[model samples]
Target: MTMTDNPPAVADGFVVRRSIDIAAGIDRVWAAVTQPDLIAQWFGDRCRLDSLEVGAGGAFGWDDAGDFPFRIEEFDPPRAIAYRWSNAVAGALDPLQVVDAHSTLFRFTLEERPGGTRLTVVETGFESHERPDAVVEDHRQGWTSELDELVALVEGAA
Candidate 1:
């Protein structure tokens, strides 16, 4: 995976934004972002999408990071998907619980370019969490690596 020069930026205080261009169509990119099997290949060790609808919820588990509860807030196929997820904590939580101030919003947007797709990811609401700086920094590194992996997977397939 070739990492792009696009650096993560702090937006609206604690929000982090990262973007990359992938050599694939919007449908392919969307699947890589929304499908659990495809997401696990890059985003985490394992992922289980309980639901893919706008009001659905899911869980992602990592060997080292434990589990994260996520709820889908928006689902626009081949374009955008927005969800709120809990920060990495020690214990497991209820995926159906309401998103509190501590949770963060992750939004993935795809735009069709001339030859491929431009993917942008924005994660916000870190200021409401404890150790906002550390969380932002951790996710900054994580998104960079994960997005690079996504690019590698999708582009390789192309």
Candidate 2:
């Protein structure tokens, strides 16, 4: 596994940001992230989406943690993508006062480096969570483990 100079940290109160450099090209990294088959290898146990375009609906399922539904907020090829999901009800989008209040948006940004690619995940909107501190900490640690798996898979393929 490669090393990350900067580990994930919560910033600006509501955002948790993390970045890792993978020993692979942008295309490979993009495929691993954007493709359902490849994402299952790292991000979740199973992934389902209506389509690849923005505003698509999907769910990431894990036997232990259950499935969480999400909406595609952005879809830019080989560069960036983002999803908004709400965990208030677990496995579904909660009917909160404001949709944005209880929903979290996670963005993936990929940049081509000379030897590989740098992938960053920034998840925000935790301030409105029932337990903001706990939720932030959970996801902050979650990203480390999830991306560790992603780096292993992508780098091993490279």
Candidate 3:
């Protein structure tokens, strides 16, 4: 995975292109990504997953925030998982007004590299956001920290 010294470029109100290398096997990385319990340790404050099967749906959010509804639009075990992220109502929270106009896609690609696994996350379809730059930066930091946590968790460094 290429570690960019700069954040990815924001194109059409959407930022794309960032990858991370984890010192773990694809299976380990896949588990950390697809499993609800482990995902929260790395990605979110809390994760509520119904299934990892293709076209399945789930909700994941910070413990302090409401659950964000999501649907598994595409899934390929141990290789890729693409999902639709929404700020819609999950538990008493109204639909996210800021995210209502934009439909974002999160794609996770995993590959077995020579030393470990290379994980790439690409999010697109953000040209509709009023503040796309801010959103991009938010995700940039979020993914970076999450990937770091994932590496630590899978490598027993945490």
TM-score for each model: 0.89, 0.88, 0.80
Span of ten consecutive residues with least summed lDDT in model 2? 89-98
Model 3, 67-115: lDDT tens digits are 7767777789899998777643345443432243445788899999986
Candidate 3 lDDT score at position 42: 77
Q: Where does candidate 1 stray beyond 4 Å? A: 1-12, 95-99
Which lDDT tens digits does candidate 2 get at residues 1-158?
A: 55434465455577889888888899999998888888889987987777888988877777787677778899999899998876565534543221566689999999999889999999988878778888888888888888988888888888
Per-residue lDDT of candidate 1, residues 1-158 (tens digit)? 44334454444458788878887889999999899999999888888788789878777778987778788999888889998887746474554463566588899999999878999999988887668889888888888788878888888887
lDDT value for model 2:
0.81
**Cα deviation of 154 in candidate 3 (Å)?**
1.2
Candidate achieving the largest TM-score: 1
The TM-score measured for candidate 1 stands at: 0.89
lDDT of each: 0.81, 0.81, 0.71
Q: lDDT for model 1, on a 0 to 1 scale?
A: 0.81
Instruction: Please tell me which model should have the higher lDDT, number 1 or number 3.
Output: 1
Going through the candidates in the order shown, the clash numbers are 0, 0, 0
